[model samples]
Target: MLQNLSSPSLQPSSASPSPFTHHSSQNYSHAKPWPLQKRPLTRLSCASSGPKRKMVPQSEKLEAEQLVRSIMWNMNGKEPVLKTLNKYVRVVRTEHCFLLFEELGKNDKWLQCLEVFRWMQKQRWYVADNGVYSKLISVMGKKGQIRMAMWLFSEMRNSGCRPDTSVYNALITAHLHSQDKAKALGKALGYFEKMKGIEWCKPNTVTYNILLRAFAQARNVEQVDALFKDLHESIVSPDIYTYNGLMDAYGKNGMIREMESVLSRMKSNQCKPDIITFNLLIDSYGKKQEFDKMEQVFKSLLRSKEKPTLATFNSMIINYGKARLREKAENIFQKMKNMGYTPSFITCESLIMMYGLCDCVSRARDIFDGMVQSGKEMKVSTLNAMLDVYCMNGLPMEADMLFKSAKGLGIVPNSSTYKLLYKAYTKANMKELLQNLLEHMDRDGIVPNKRFFLEALGAFQSLPAGMETATATTVVGSPLGRSKT
Candidate 1:
């Protein structure tokens, strides 16, 4: 047995507070200031009018993105963009300016993109890089700005940034974007041959993909086969993207056997079919009205781990609708909803058009109404779908009503909308509505071109002789009617 140590002598002194109590009641007022340390000296100028900007530690990439966004937001025109950029070119890093140039290029502002490129060239810190030129060339090509893209290639060479496979690929793609397909293909092939001769500029997988896609789109089967053979022989292994590109091009051209062969080859290569591969197969089969094949692919997609995307459902719905399988289309739509996939504008538009085509105008209207009630942004296509349904169902009055309320719905009717409405009004002999539409077109600066006249004449030609005379009599008094008479 041990005696309890409760002696007074073992207790803390009352005059001195315990260590914990002392810390808890710290005397901040009497605390000594930390000793000042000498900071590294930076050069200062008294001549500066404003206080120097504090160097905030941030990622160069993030800063670059912010600078680009700032310029874009303040951009009024090319001149303004140049002026604004001039102020920042010195302050921002070189890599940031490159990003800015890419952003402008992506927006289809090719002239502004060129200005930035030229501005970058003039900068003291600017070093020629293949990436910058390749990106610019790709963008210019997408917009069919072939001349600018070619000039950029020349500029890149002059800047000592030797053109690589990527640069050549972009050049080939730009040429393919031109309206003269045959000429463009010839130029692309010329570049391909040129690329093959140079060891440093040897064509890569992207190079092969670009050429194969262009040739396939042109429906040049001989060229596609030759390119495919060349790709196989090349050291660079073709990826899924390469096969997908060829498959899409072939599918669009109605080469079902060729597309399937590509799929089989993809499987043999041990390249697992991704979502895009299945989507293309489904869409192609649907277009061909080969429902069994389409269903087989859909089931295969489901069996695999690859999740069905919005595109997958859209293709299924569109195809089912095309085949007049209304119940099947609706079932797919319901399934899409159950899978927690939100309906997009394209989805709504497809359903509306499908229902309208199947002579279910009420169901189409219901879908359109649901979209509106759900606060979804109604696109011009959605409006067109509903208007088309009304027109197709011989309900021109309803179509006219929707057209009149287009402004309220934030829809700026394009020529297609006008054409649909005109056809309906003309057929129904709604002279008042037709005249109003012509006036609206004039007001909107939508010139009634030859296409409009030809379509209107064709519509009238389909009517009985008596009805045609009545329509002419109704139109003759109106402004456009007088010109026609």
Candidate 2:
């Protein structure tokens, strides 16, 4: 059993909050937070005991990524990543361990993260550093392991690591990921208030960014306004990320007025709009189907000094495709190419989706075939996009035909492909097609779970009752099907 290493509940008063001392050594600025853009893999200058926190060379950084990738590639699905970490205990330093946190966090291997932390504690170089705890808290938080995150916070204080802005920020983020979001926000504000008092734990720009985005995501307009006001009054000046985060949250939530208001605030502050700023406006307007505004933003982006990124083009293409503006979507694609932008796999997929939405099946397939013939590595999503187009156009047999040849094309179908096909086949009332898909799923060792059935049955719900009953019986009796409990 993996040991339970969580100490007592966090008593912030018990630990003497140490003033952060910057490392004078040219190689390190260990006392500071790991830059958010870098995460665990970015660099190796975390504050820790002993002499290990130093500026690691690029080779060392690559070594960490390579080591994690190798472990992931070699795992037997059940062996603990900690088991692999054990073999590399000597080679794995603080930087390598940090990268491990990120990679494992991606896979939601939060327990393994704890196990790795426990292992790190036994090592001679181990120190109760805020960066390590902040990262652990972040990983657990992302995994929705709120209790675990809380434990790590307590453990950090117990280990004599003083809580800093980064650690508190991570904790606040972890709470926000919890199901009781209202409670989480309250706790986050509580912490934000607390941070103001503690000189060493004072809220920084990151702290404000986290809260601002959180409130915006919750559509708590009043709170967002208050936070923004508080931010402006504070010593910390908002950066591009500040406006971008606010705009993105509001844009995604369809709070157009709030989004535009934030953009205006960004302008009033004289923070020049970057590519991200333009892209967010385009996406927001496109989502609301306000094509005129989207195009206006696009035109402005063209006039700006900043170059449009792949996201800018991809958003335009997909949104145009969604609106069945095939010519416009095509024009955007042409413009991308004319401007020397090579189409990404996602770009190709967007074109496929666009063509399908516009009833241009032949055109979509033409692009797919061209991509395949060019020896571009076929991704499951790309294939799924093509299959989805066929299904959307009432071409079940065609989708099955392409799906059957997927392995031959060096593209393997995952559960998503199976789910897509099953839903489509069931809705079409094609028994043979559904059975064949089930067979393929079995061969791929994918057992259809309740969620899969629920989604497939959701498609069945709109059909005549007799047809729904008939298809459900077929599903339950199939070799690979398990009835929902």
Candidate 3:
């Protein structure tokens, strides 16, 4: 069990159960928090209008970044961050602290982010502001720490800081991150309604963006429609993120017509399609195996001002691979290379899976070999991609051989790797091989937990075996395996 992973990315309603979601990819970058947009959908910040922030010079920004990274390396036996902060107290500024939150938040160190916040408060220059509380709430929310976020909201008020639109937005988004979908949805709506009566905390586009995504993912079509109607009647206008999040939610739920309806509404509102919009369209069509429409969208993307990204290519390759459109997938890869797009480990994994589906196991092996010999550190998933090909293609022996040699390649196998192998070995009815794998699992200190035992009763739903694929915090361009926009 990957307990309480703070991915914070939205997904289709588990209730909808789309076949497309069984694709089984991991570590995608598109899982950033809601309103996953590069541009500010609107000036929706709850930060009271203040003097313009002077841009930190590039040199100062780089210096601050280096300082944050150094503190993070924990190079000493003791707490380097607190010690360094005391020694270099002069450098302790709002921007630097924000950078600290970012680095710490990535590693699930929300408590440390709070420590830094406390340290800031102790400074003579520190001032309590809605922005600080909002940032902290957002960080806690992303970590699935809803109670902490609520406490922070209360603490902000106790500190004489008024809750603002931005603060409410963070609180609502945090609620959505909670495990109980029904409770989370109800609580988010409660906050949404509460924000309405507060004069200064009135809802903004960002607020709507967050709520719309929540309801959309909950499959509450009526509520989604009601929200949009309210948006039209209000002074706040919908933006790219608003439409993008809704469409993405619908698309993931296999509500293609609703997704398209969003596109039409978007055009009617004069909100232009950006890269996310195009990628979402491509992914939706690809999953439905509507090749002509997918290709048309790709062509349109090429004609647009926004260029294609690695995600764009990765999604197409995996989708084509799933359909066994081997040549088209290869052509896309070639085009990606010709466009000077460098394939990442993700792209390589997609390629491996693609080739496997095309019955070109040897070709898949060549790619995996290049990845191994590239001398770059490899991911377990990349190796699993090759292993998946072998296991899936009825070559458990070859997969076993690769698994044994994984340590030599500096790749450490995790539970997923074991799960994949376990499924394959049992499927092949190789008793001796299963015993060998058990030895490896025991040696590695991995327990074959109860659920894993349950899994033994069914064939491992290897990724796609069948079908198919974003990076970037804002998820600008590529759309294969992203969080619902």
Candidate 4:
């Protein structure tokens, strides 16, 4: 059992609140009170210390096992929960260990599940049964452990367990996800052919869905067409998952025409689009900067009775704000409020950027300042955004001051910050200051790129009379470079 490490008490360094110190007051102009704290989640059992026990009662073990099962179920079948359960299983010694392993594998905890499987093999009660090996192989394949999964599938047959279509589909999915996808797909096709030859185990719609989704995600549009043709020839009908996977793949890959074609195909097949279908289309449209199309999809989502999740609003806010359509962005921000959706850090960041880009520097600063006051932790990205706003509004002095305060608070400036400083220094035409910053950038691993050096050279060329004459570095040979002509 891992002991919980207590958080150390660290004090803030200065008497005066650093300008970089977080302000927690949220912008109530458009957004409602977005609660920052969520209900405390049940800590992973492995991360928490267990009670000391000596020969625990069967009833006690049963109660603890039930609690573990509850945790596993509530986590929506995640791998972290399985890892925690496996650790707890060792401590409690439960008979339902295999069930835990199965659930673990379903959650993609293949390595931890394998640990339990190997442990089972060492036990006297271990039986090389078909169901056991099939489950193990299916789990391994789902996790992309194709070689191990295939070996287990063969071993199952050797141990007298019959091969099934379900087992074959799992292996196919695993093979498709493998790094050597072409090789895996070839092997899958061979297995499919062998299944047909045997006549005992036949490929089903599920197997075809797996193959379709694999081709879709791989962006092998040619292979997708071929697979569809083969499926039609075999009379294996495609399902909603098949279409949804293809839509998502096309949307993600920025193939708008391909995505629309798939949607048209789905409609022709009499398949009604779902919320996921609408969401993916909207997301893809937004990514393409096709705001008009994105809005159309969003409206369709509402008409379909699918209550927009936080994700839906977040996408709109960011996309609109990025396009500098502040009015539309603010309207969505207000709508999110009316819907009882509180603005997150991401929302605030979008607001800051939107305001900044629109030349509303003071408003952007107010949002940033209020965010800090509201106890929301300012991420480095947010800080950079504020810093950019300062520099852009001809306030490099203020930007430099903020940088100093940020550094004191241990917020290391990144390359973006250096770039901003280079721009600021050149605009100010402070040769000594620029040289000092160049040294600082080098120290911070922000090596000046060609563009940065060109900007610096341009600033030097544009320097005022006395500024250039007194500050210019001398070249050994040239008249002005050597001594004043």
- The numbered model that scores best in lDDT is 2
Candidate 3 residue 155 Cα shift, in angstroms, is 1.5
In candidate 4, which residue ranges exceed 4 Å CA deviation?
1-110, 123-145, 195-200, 344-485
Estimate every model's Cα lDDT from 0 to 1: 0.72, 0.77, 0.73, 0.62
How well does candidate 1 score on lDDT at residue 470? Answer: 73
Task: Estimate, for each residue in 179-277, the C-alpha lDDT of model 1 and write its tens digit.
Answer: 999999999889999989998788877778778877887888888889888988989887766777788888888998888777767665656555667
TM-scores of the candidates are 0.79, 0.85, 0.80, 0.56
The residue-by-residue lDDT of candidate 4 on 1-485, one tens digit each, is 00100102111111212111111111001111111111133421111011222464678556756865864664455546445544554443323454555567766768766666666556443444444554566567667787898887777666555666656665666676677877877877777777666654577766666666666767888988987888778856876556767777777789888888887777666655555566677777887889888887776656553456566776777677667788998898898899898777767777777787777888888988797788755677778888887876777777777776776544678877777776666667655555666566656656555555455456556566666444444211223223322
Task: Output candidate 2 Cα RMSD.
Answer: 11.0
User: Candidate 3, clashing residue pairs?
Assistant: 469-480, 469-481
Candidate 3 segments whose C-alpha is farther than 4 A from its true place: 1-52, 75-84, 445-457, 460-485
Candidate rank order under TM-score: 2, 3, 1, 4
lDDT of 3 by residue, 1-485 (tens): 01111112211111211222221111111112211112233433333322235454678768878877776776243675567678768766666676777678778989888888888778765656566677788789989998898999898888777787777877887888899999999998898889899898788877888888778888898999999999999999997678778888887887888888887787666566666777777888787888887888787767665666677888899999999999999999999999998999989999999999988999999999999889999999898899999987999999999999999999999998988987887677665777677667767877655667466546533323321010111112212112231
Q: Please tell me which model should have the higher lDDT, number 1 or number 2.
A: 2
- The lDDT ranking, best first, is 2, 3, 1, 4
Candidate 3 vs candidate 4, TM-score winner = 3
